[model samples]
Target: MSLPPRAHQLHVLACHACGMVLEDALDSTGHGRCPRCTAVLHRRRPNSIARAWALLIAGLLFYIPANVLPVMFTSRLGSGSDNTILQGVIEFWHGGSYGVALVIFIASVVVPCSKFVILGLLLITVQRRSAWARRERARLYRLVELVGYWSMLDVLVVAIVAALVKFQSLSDIEPRSGILFFGMVVILTMLSAMQFDPRLIWDSEDT
Candidate 1:
């Protein structure tokens, strides 16, 4: 089957932000701005693949420390305890807070690992220019972006809990290094997703 012609083939560009179609002639300086929303337009994001890969790798490195080290330090009655991400989840589960445990497990462990795997898969497939599963790959990229937003839930939870525990006379909760690492993973993955251009999935087909 023949593919449809792209907008650039007709000397037009679509605004990524507002979806406005502008004539190629308007792009005098290599960069173009949409008249409606004035958002800058690019044929494709510059260095999208390379930037995404770099961020993904950095996030992966941080993921190790994020899970291994202590995320929260709790002190009560002259005794202190440190809890890693998994340890905290286990404690919540054993303490009968199943809902909270499930949320944290999904947000902290499952989400980050899934993002890494999916992003890595998309990156590899796109770089190889594989025409296989083009539609499904496109959907996977969108799904990555959607779930990236919730990846920071665990960090927020730690912060809120620490703040609430600050007022207790005999107990205190403070964030540890692991939470910082986890936060970096979340930010890096989110930026990696943003850097990716989903349009690339169809480039080979269009060619």
Candidate 2:
């Protein structure tokens, strides 16, 4: 008897949670619910394209305020000032903590914006059913997903800085509206990436 092909090429849906094959389940429910894990199974995620587009657009919109607004408020000896993400990075860079500044700039600004552009390109190419570099497109999806969570590094940095300064006698730090906006952007992008079905890249044979 011939063994089945690799698991991913099965052309069958499975329980995303419990690893249960769901091809048979489709005959029963329009969207089958896994008996083992209760996850809703689909040959393809329902409205995957639409949902990802919506989330991506929202993330893009939020990206504006995330950068423009101040992310932190700092007061030392009764003199206080607000710092946006770029401002903080510039200050850090000038203050000789270039490494931390670079990390913050990349994680906070570059990563988020690039994720938007990358997701946008993926969605468009998938919609057009463009067969260009199908394998590489799948790889791109993986790369974006891997880096998505790292954008939270900026938030972590802010929180740490705030905590450290909270107890200082003449200096204190508090997060600003921009940080909240940036967090929303990160979350929306993550959801967008999750909503995209990488399998779509492999659905068609490469030209």
Candidate 3:
């Protein structure tokens, strides 16, 4: 059977230098490069908008629990303690780790939520064919892409604490619901970043 029109068009734009056609580029690790110029020919991911929406929605759903539940449980000297993201931030602030706390709050909470909201707004604007500040919208999309990975900071912290604080009975750190939810939020945002297409913004400008 013949491929769809869009797929056929993508294939026609294959990089002559790399001999990579767009049809085979949708895999997670797959990329198409120009054989001659070594330039990227085309991104193979399909249904980028739909994938982004799915990820964004999932992230939004998980963000609630990531903030509400305890992210870490600390057991030291037979005394146990649990901290949510906000509680941890407050502790860090009061303990004079203000900078660290700020970084954690922004990366673990603010950035992800901001990306989701910004991307959703951009998508909605584009879908509505709103011609307002196309350039600005593109810039926002780039920002979202840049900040998407930082959401993993919380997960990294949890993993590191889990690894380093392995005192077994005397003192130990355990991952909590918030950590898992935070991880999901990060993954979902990353997926959203990957799925979003900046070209759509430009396409709106042309229309």
Candidate 4:
């Protein structure tokens, strides 16, 4: 009996111990354990570059307007004001909601931007097959994945304020252009993360 020529290609593997699927291709040694569960793993998928590219591009596109447009509108006692994402953060900070402001700053502004930059770096590095700081790159990818959803905090806040502060003539809250852009940013980053193939980092090292 002979194995197929493609059988040696790196592919996603499943762990027999914890039942967790490894995102990267199996080690050439024909035996590798799951990073999460330390269980023996098997090949599952061969490549993930195309999906990752699409996601990163989408995220890059949405990153633009997330910062440019106004995220919320507030009307108080017949006086209305619209604030961009940064302005809202500043308002919260000036109004003594420092903690809330900080959270929003990190989640809405910093995290999304950072995620994009980091993912972009990783993609570029993988494409160039650069092996420097392999561990650091992997760590950065995990961080991006973890913080990706946090960017939606702004959207959540908008929804909450819109629902709770509906005083009509007295006070009213409305979604702004930034909200849409910000939402797209969140969605795009998530898509990027989903599209990204973490296994590539390790594969580059072997090559």
Candidate 5:
């Protein structure tokens, strides 16, 4: 069976922000401004793979310290304790809040790391002009885009907990440097995914 032609064959590009279709699309450097919303248009994102790799690498670098350092500091009657991400997850598991623990572990650790891996693979394959599994690769890109934002779930939880669990002298919960690093990880990975242009996956003639 013959497959349907892709949008690129028509020499048009869709505006991501406003869904406007511009004909004769050739603004790859993002200099062409969209007439409707004034958003810059790029046929293919400029330096997409490189920018994505940079952000992904930064996210990975931050991931280490974020897991090592304490994300939360707690004090009860002047006695202070620090808890890292894994420590908190384990604590939650031991305390029988399995659902929340699982959610945190997946959202905070698995999602971001998997996103990095997936995006890295996509970039490598696109650069090599691999014709293997073009449709599947495009699906993978959509999956990455969908889940990238969810990595922030743990960060939001931490912020909310810190906000709610405050006490003057009896007990207190405050965010530490680890969560800040983790936040950066989430943000960087999301940005990385956004910077990646899925159109590159099908750039080769065979694809």
Candidate 6:
């Protein structure tokens, strides 16, 4: 079956800012602006795949240390123990703080791991130009963006709990290097998502 022509092939560009449609030539520089809204119109983001790949790899590198190192230290009386993210979740679960455990598990462990997998899949399929499940892949990319907004939930929970416990005479909580690494993973993954161009999924191919 023959596919219909794409808007780019017709030289029609829509303004992302104001929905203004304009006809322009695609060039090496992708230099042009929407006359109504003055928004830069580009066929694709420059270095989109390259930038996304770099950020994704950096996030993966930090993922290991983020899981292995102690994310927090809890000192009760004169003794203390180092708790990695998983250990903290386990502790909360055993201590009957089920809700807190579930929240932390989802935000800290599940969400980040899912982002790594989903982002990797998108990058791989786009590079391969695989037409399989194009719509599903696009939806996964959107899912990545949506979850990013809550990526910091785990970090914020820790910070809030630490602050609240600071007033106690015998108990105190302190963040560790793992939390910092995890924070970096979150930031890098979010940036990676932003760097990716979703339009690439439907370009130069027919579904």
Tens digits of per-residue lDDT for model 2 on 1-207? Answer: 974463345656677777787455475657668878887776677788999999999999999999899999999988899999999889989999999988888898888888998899999999988889987888889999988899998888889988888746588999999999999999999999999988787665533
Error of 1 at 102 (Å): 1.6
Between prediction 2 and prediction 5, the one with superior TM-score is: 5
Name model 1 segments beyond 4 Å from true: 1-4, 26-28, 167-169
Order by TM-score, highest first = 1, 5, 2, 6, 3, 4
RMSD of 2: 3.2
Which runs in model 4 stand beyond 4 Å of their true positions? 1-12, 15-47
Off by over 4 Å in 6: 1-5, 16-19, 26-30, 167-169
lDDT of 6 by residue, 1-207 (tens): 987777787878777668777786557446788778778876677799999999999999999999999988888886788989899889889999999899888989899999999999998999998888989999999999998758687677778877877735488888889889999999999999999999899974854
Estimate TM-scores for all models: 0.92, 0.89, 0.79, 0.78, 0.90, 0.88
Q: On residues 26-76, what C-alpha lDDT tens digit does candidate 4 reach at each position?
A: 445566667887766654333455676777677777767777878889999
Q: List the residue pairs that clash in candidate 6.
A: none
Clashes of 6: 0
Residues 29-141, candidate 5, lDDT per residue (tens digit)? 43677889988776777899899999999989999999999999988998989999899889999999999899888888888888878988998998899988989999989
For model 6, the local distance difference test gives 0.86
The count of residue-pair clashes in candidate 5 stands at 0
Error of 4 at 180 (Å): 1.5
| lDDT winner | 1
- Native-referenced Cα lDDT, model 1: 0.89
Q: Tell me the lDDT of model 5 at 178.
A: 92
Better of 4 and 5 by lDDT: 5
Residue clash pairs of candidate 3: 17-34, 17-35, 17-36, 18-34, 18-35
For candidate 4, list the clashing residue pairs, or say none. Answer: 11-25, 12-44, 12-45, 13-42, 14-42, 52-195
Best by TM-score: 1
